[model samples]
Target: MKYTHTMPFGAAVHDNGVRFTFWAPDTALIALERNGLAAAPMTRDADGWHRLDVPDARAGDRYQFRLPDGHLVPDPASRSNPDDVHAASEVVDPQAYDWKDAEWRGRPWTEAVIYELHIGTFTPEGTFVAAQRRLADLVALGITVIEILPVADFPGARGWGYDGVLLFAPTAPYGTPDELKALVDAAHGLGLMVLMDVVYNHFGPEGNYLHAGSPSFFNAAHQTPWGSAINYDGDSSRTVRDFFVHNALYWVEEFRCDGLRMDAVHAIRDDSSPDIVEEICAALRDGPGRERQIHIVLENDANGAHYLERGADGRPLTATAQWNDDLHHAAHVLVTGDTDGYYADYADDPVAQFGLALAQGFVYQGQASVFRDGEHRGEKSDQLPLAAFVSFLQTHDQVGNRAFGDRIDALADPAPLRAAYACLLLSPHAPMLFMGEEYAASTPFLYFCDFGPELAAAVSDGRRAEFGKFAAFGDEAARARIPDPNAASTFEASKLKWEEREQSPHREFMAHIAQLLAIRHRALVPRLAGQPRGGRHWRDGEALRVEWPLANGATLQLLAHFGTQKASGIRQLAGQAIYTDGITTDLNDTLSMAPGSVCITLQEDNTHG
Candidate 1:
């Protein structure tokens, strides 16, 4: 059939048939192979987009593209890869699913209490439908946002999703694309906004077919740790940029995702004016039916405060927020006293480092980074609103990338861990909790993959070699004990033991977290959503004092004693004890705090000099 269509750059179902469009500028000839049928020539436009409308093809029909070299490739924008990443793409009707969240306008960024979870390991079933069963639990726990790890189709049945190759297809193991939508819809129904993590820096090593059709998808001038950088600023960059920008919109518009967490944006490497990140944010904001406010966050190691800067029109140029590693690093060091690798920088004065991170958005703003060979890093972001930072005590990388996959709670004493949780929840920045972290589930989130034998061996060896540099993993015995990424048991071991949520210490921890979140909702969130009145932090001996004036005629003060000895007569009395972790007795002008204790007090005196 020959007709013009206004659908997106992927497989779209129409009243008569399924229309397929792909961008392959480097290919001379392209054809469509539908349901294992003979290859049919596809009409090509001057813009290098190949189009084919097959009246016989309908929803559930399998299709693949035959390149100039006669190699079949899955659609780059496939919505559902039911078989696997390398298999044929299935035609899906986007409008077929019945969504009940029509009245669901997403929550604002200021009220976000994100809980990051890996879908595969979140539940025993490890599917979207299964994960949806726990949404009510999160709602009860006061989680406003749920940040799921990447769902893009990868090589095998299980992975961390960082190795996703088919960016559009939700992994088959987790369930169908419609099921994934159901999960998002269910979350929205419970008043929870769902944000998905997307990796655009580089495609995965396996099952990547973009190069078979067009080399312009990647840039030779730039390289990232993962692989070649995407051609965002190189020749034929506009098409490459559009491919990803459409993917972002696909999730937001088609899947009804509330937001996205762009992974490793520092590796994007664009020198062009109004960088690719800016283009993506603008496109998302200007998308069709832009009624719901869309939020974009960045996971940037560079601490790029510019990503959060507003343009002349007073809208954020790139992302609404960036992950604050400075806060995490300082908090980790303070709680565990571990000064290895990047944690070395925060070791000298963890409290001071954390204080700087609280007062400013970054601790390394023009300061020498001891881990980076004394190189000055980061830019000033103190003027930005606290909502521009996402702070957490533990994250996927912080916990899973460890040699033993030990969480902060596993490494620290209960007293300090509780204190750290108070700091994270009460901080001005938005706080996130890793899966199973609130109750301290004993399951270790080890790095697992499902690569073939050869790639699996290589991954196992590379993992060992990477961690071998650390003294903890230097011993041959310890190195041998590292979980093999290829092992099914390793993947199974990472699953959360939901039963533990009702156990002794786990129950206590959950209650504490619930109380802390209640306090945040009652006291902190209101003040945070208002005009950005700046805050202050100071250190006295081994104790830290943080005070921020609220919209009401009161000030919020957090007094934390990080030293081993008890701090006596730390500070004067306050209005009310909003939250306390390890403090005992009422507070007067001469209150004492046990070691590793934290108290959050509300002082009625807002005019303190």
Candidate 2:
């Protein structure tokens, strides 16, 4: 039998039926204020867990927590349903959803070219089924996986999925439970892996109801910019951690998802003996003896390698992958040269950006950061494989955080932007792209949400005023102009024009991305398959060269030019121009590199021959 952690017991949903549970360690009496059903008294267990089995409770149920004083609210441990965000939770029959990916094992992190996208804005329709229609486009572009932004139920049909309140439900605005399954099935049919991003940091301020029942799911010990930190190591913390771990496993097993990207793990604080992260990792590593390889990525700026390291038992724990923010910062600072905000720390050091991102994981390793005020340390990545870092030129936070909801195109020259693109994809690390970035879509990805009047005002006025206080990050005066969540235009401005791919410049850029992806797949993928571990080499700023040397004489050099200015040198490869980017193939012997192009070929002519 598989070992299960005993939670403080807020709520339980098994295959048979849901045993409504709660850990009110401090409560004298707890009642259930269920929606669509009559209120009932819950029986308290000796361990402070309240239990009331509802056999008739099938899928599509909406419920919440009720206090003894007649105070009614949503469930603190709601698998779904909070503030009517995405509708009520359903008792989904996991077995009913047929998965066609039975032959679809999994893709290694090293070989993955993840495309991070928000479902709502990915297409004109902005629905799960609508997004599924584009699966062929991603597959044709040589993308192996789609890392979706947080899809857990959040308030309204708009907004970034981060402020999710319902921990266990997929966002209803996207689609129904069956529709999500269909989307996953469609992706698998195209040989694409699907990764769902999940947030366990802190509940959004609008629909948080843990205070109504088990109020200890938060800690006053430390604070984060969003809200109070999660109760990872606080009183009755075991249950809180269990709640999240179960949610994570449910997505993997129940949804049959290929992987999960844990959002903002840095916000989780745990000084306990057996760390919450460790516990979660162990649960994932169960079943088959490590060959299954269900990927679990983390988004942390801590620059710690141990987070992805294995335990003494040979079980991987830290994370399979993480967002390489340093790479983004370096690339952004060099190409755009925007010397405001947090980027102030990275101005005038583009080569440093390239070198650090090449040799180590982050450029801010062990350096005194003026923005941070203290010396920040990063893990030594010399022995680590390059795939440990997942890089991108643009992401939701990097673009949406701007006061005006601007993208890189707003401030960067197209030529240099192309150069940055080559640098990102051709680098040793795994590369990711935001939606519509390949064709240089002009629409801005803004921050929008639908909340109650008071919360909406607090978010628009208060959040904007607070973020604007960081004059070091951007123009303080323009902060007031940040897109308001209440405005319909905010959501409309973020949608992608699906038809633009057929246009002139957009078509050309799209072709460039497709060519780049092919080269990476043909030249770089095999090296990882043989070596499993990744490798790289550094070159002058004029040209960045990465060599992945394998067991045999098999080796590959991912060559890319950094500057947008036309570059030419006589000696690199005399006759082969089979795979090239940003450069025109005049003939077999001569090559003219456009601003942001790259070439992938055998390290030596003899290898190809």
Candidate 3:
């Protein structure tokens, strides 16, 4: 089987020829420049689209567009740009590659144990082919989904891929477009689903020539952290909205991606009804989702509970789930005790906050956030199912954006981190791990990027300045110790030392995780299909308690102690103890929870039996 996502714009190959189309409403004259053929003038329509037809164009042919002023730019919807984002685009026949996993419809959202990874650093080779070799390991580790960082072509040799300019093209440094498809196909063949991370919030500051060609692509009325906001609801914004919506479809349909995890959607300021996000989700739901379980997850800081609404059948109406920052922030405070920045909100009572997250999804449901200057954040999330929130101890942003780029294992005690991991994987919520979290790999996921000299120094200096807010980096000398973002060593230092996984603590952690996942699949996942909601939670001294009602009339309870001192009066509840990690009970049936220990019990409804 072969797949190709035909788009309205860009180079589309047909029997007649390759029809090269460009959206340049601002420019009046346009030309197509190929390797062998002379620059041919393109006919412009009233809507600002330029079109040209070449009968001899074939796959692997390099072509670029020439503006009225003779400036050349790569296609915005390019499928592959071998040279880079700034160079010519290679005409790709997506159907050229035979897809192996045609029968892979995708796993249900409830079965998701997402492992978010960066293609550039997932393996030693940092290419699609190299990353494909590691899928069997993840499958053995019980990961259902592999969420890769943005592969859309961004400028420079190294990047996080969030600043991508060409939204449709796969980055050249990571290998060819067919190689990416192969990676996805290999993952599906291994019974694992692949999810691509897409950024619609803002294009990278550099190598984006949309403003030069399509000046109306942005709205000046609204400003974002990264310049003007994308023109989703403004005048001439229809095409802009279509561009992103099509990009989402392209990944799922053409690349055969299981789903897409949209990055920082809160930054996408749109005022239209059924806004850009809704439109994209609707398109996915009606498009590829009609045949398969194509999921859409969001990293929305806005805490938009409405977007996570489920239908009568308990499937998502729009987004499948959201990255639960509330859960991470609460757990981070309990683990690291660093109550600075946004962690300050959870610092007051992290255990309670963590309990709230476990029971009700969001802790700050319409409550005043001290970190946000007394502003009320989040909506009522008690009604949402536990699976609607994707919980994790570490993510790329949580780890990489830190001053030292320390993993949870590095900052907190092994016992606490282990307890957190148990809580993360054992719960009803979907759990995600950073690339190396399974084995607790030793390398730091530092924020590294390669920009031109003009922006390189400013970016390096700004990275240092951002850390100045922390008390540890009080002085310039301390701040200077922070790695340079643009340095080659910084990117190299961030790669996972795979050899360390076979070492002492890492191997133990990996075994522990595998055990937890085994229990989760055996005990919990079977109960998730009936729609389980987060239950009640309360604090008993230093012990945090939470109970969730499962779909099969089972009450799943968790008793965890995060304090340095041992927590007493953790009553041994009337249930079958499924998992006990460093938790003990006295002879008198009085329970004692050691610091950084967890105990999980399940009470089946015997009343009906």
Cα lDDT of model 2 by residue, 75-111, tens digit = 5545445236523344444444667666666766667
Model 1, range 545-564, lDDT digits (tens) per residue? 87765555567788888888
Q: Which ten residues in a row have the lowest lDDT in candidate 1?
A: 1-10
Compute the lDDT of residue 529 as modeled in candidate 2: 41
Instruction: Report every candidate's CA lDDT.
Output: 0.85, 0.71, 0.89
TM-scores of all predicted structures? 0.95, 0.88, 0.98
Q: Identify the candidate with maximal TM-score.
A: 3
Write model 3 residue lDDT over 293-329, tens digit each, in one string.
8988899887989999888878888898999999999
In candidate 3, position 44 carries an lDDT of 92
User: What TM-score number comes out for model 1?
Assistant: 0.95
Judging by lDDT against the true structure, name the best candidate: 3
lDDT measured at residue 364 in model 2 versus the true structure, 0 to 100: 63
1 against 3, candidate with superior lDDT:
3
Q: Which stretches of candidate 2 lie over 4 Å from their true place?
A: 1-18, 33-37, 82-90, 287-291, 310-317, 466-480, 530-554, 558-560, 563-601, 604-609
